[model samples]
Target: MRDTYIIGVGMTKFGRAGDWTLIDVLEYAAARALEDAGLGENVESVFVANMGAGILNRLSGLGSAMVDRLCLFPAAAETVENGPASGGSAVKIGAMAVGSGAVDTALVVGGEVMRAVTGWEATDFVATLTHPEAEYIYGVTLPALAGMFARLYMDKYGVTPEHLAMVAIKNHENAMKNPDAHIQQTVTMEGLLHRPEAVVNNPYVAEPLRMFDCCPVSDGAAAVVLCSREVAERSGKPLVRIAGFGQATDTHAVHEREDPTELAAVRTAAERAFAMAGRKPADVDVAELHDAFTILEIAQSEEAGFFERGTGHIALEKGETRPGGRLPINVSGGLKARGHPVGATGVAQVVEIARHLRGEAGERQIEKPRVGFTCNFGGFGNNVVCFVLEREG
Candidate 1:
């Protein structure tokens, strides 16, 4: 197989994009990526990753519409949906296309405009991904599950609410440096925890998982352009190779897992990605984990081999995951503060790591990162996609 590389990346400001249509957000990000690559009419294919356009916007055929909007006439067009992992899944397919020599270049864009509906409606729409008979019918939502997980983990590992608040505080600080981040505000431990009225300041979404611990429901988009190495080299851009990728699945129902606290899918997926890249977890210079909830970042850190199985929260206490720390994570703010636009999140994670590798991350940039990793968790660890990206000088 031919090697694949990310030639360009772009994303729309993730927030309540008032007055912007779902297609508009997709086009905005896609055009930026295409323009970054100096690509135009000749693009070979376009894969749009989205989860709620049909349910929330009453729209479909996004792929075909995207091709027409961008004037990439006659290019193959399709939409990819794989729950919250939709974006990472789309990138995987695009890389496969380039690697297989079936396409010289592919445009992968992920977006969601969930704000059109009330937050209540959005929550119900996303819950559709849960097992219909086992999980959804009972009215269980993602936060409710995460809360249970957080409580169990805390009981087992001694992770305090302070630790959870630390994740939110740190990621929020990181988001301040990211112009496109959804919540670019600073959060302090005192404000979230120490104060007398912290409850009012940060209400509980699910016990043990407060409002600050949860990622905001956002409307946004992110895009990437993948091409073969030969094509990438011709563009005179620094190459960020898709070194390796891995994906795995677990039980669709959270309760069915043998050990709910163990993110088996994350562990297996990261191991596969690292093995394919011929690297170890210690070789990674930076990472982006799907921190849809504060606990996820800590759980994934352990499962991905960044920290010991039960010591992820301890590492967070030590400042190891900060920008200049041992292995800075979520420097692009992660989904915690960068916003989680479901389908767009996985793609956005890749975009952040790619920027880190390229040294274009500006204020949040880590120093000379040679290898970057990303994990896009889907469906409460039911499905996941992980990628190992390498920077070539």
Candidate 2:
């Protein structure tokens, strides 16, 4: 297979955009990515990632709508949906098309207008990601399931609530440097510990998972332009090669898994990716794991081999996962502080990594970065996608 490279990446600020429509956000980001690629009308194909714009905004046909808005009306357009991993799946398809020489250039976009509905309504909409007959009907929301997973992880791994809060504080501190991050507040451990009222002020969305621990419902979009190596070289932009890609799925029902704390799919996917990239976890200079909840960062770090089994929480305590530490994870504030616009998150992670590898991450930039990794988990780790990126000399 031919190699694929990301030539350009762009994203809208990930937060509540009270005035921007879904189309507006998509158009804005897509156009910027095209300009960044130095291509005006050469896109050969388009893949869009959006889970439920119809349910969220009563709008459908987002794929074709986006193509038309970009004035690439003649190009073939397809939509990909895989719960919250939808964006990563789209990027995977786009890269595969370029790798197979089926398309010289492809544009992958992930956009969502989730804030169109009220908070409770958005919660219900996201809960539909659960199995309908077996889970959703039983009133299982994402937060509720995540709470169970967090509780199990703590019980099995000796992770505490303070560890979880530390994850939040760290990411919030990182988000302060990210212009596109959703939450930019620099939270202090003292403030978190001393303010008892503030602890419960945000209130518990689900037991063991408070509001601050949960990612906010966000409205945003992100896009990337992928091309074959030959085409990328011609564009004259700094390139980050797609070194590895792997995806795996587990039983849709969370209860069916042998261990609630262990994300089998994440382990499988990361192993495949690391093998493909011919690199170990230590080789990764930076990473962006799916931190929809703070506990997920800890669970995923261990599952992805960034830390030894049951030692991820300790890694956090040692500051190994922070910037200027052993390995920086989620310098873009992550889903927790960066805002998780479900469908848009996976692609956004790629965009951030691409920036880091290209040395264009600005304040969040890592020193002498060579390799970056991203993990996108869907529906309580039932579906997981991992991408390994390397800087091209």
Q: Estimate each model's TM-score.
A: 0.98, 0.98
In model 2, the runs with Cα more than 4 Å from the true position are none
Please give, for residues 17-133, the per-residue lDDT of candidate 1 as tens digits.
799999999999998898888754468999999988999999999999999998888889999999999998999989889889999999999999999999989888988989999
Q: Mark the 10 consecutive residues where model 2 has the least summed lDDT.
A: 193-202
Cα lDDT of all candidates, in order? 0.92, 0.89
Deviation of model 2 at 36, angstroms? 0.5
| Model 1 lDDT, full chain set | 0.92
User: So what's the TM-score on candidate 2?
Assistant: 0.98
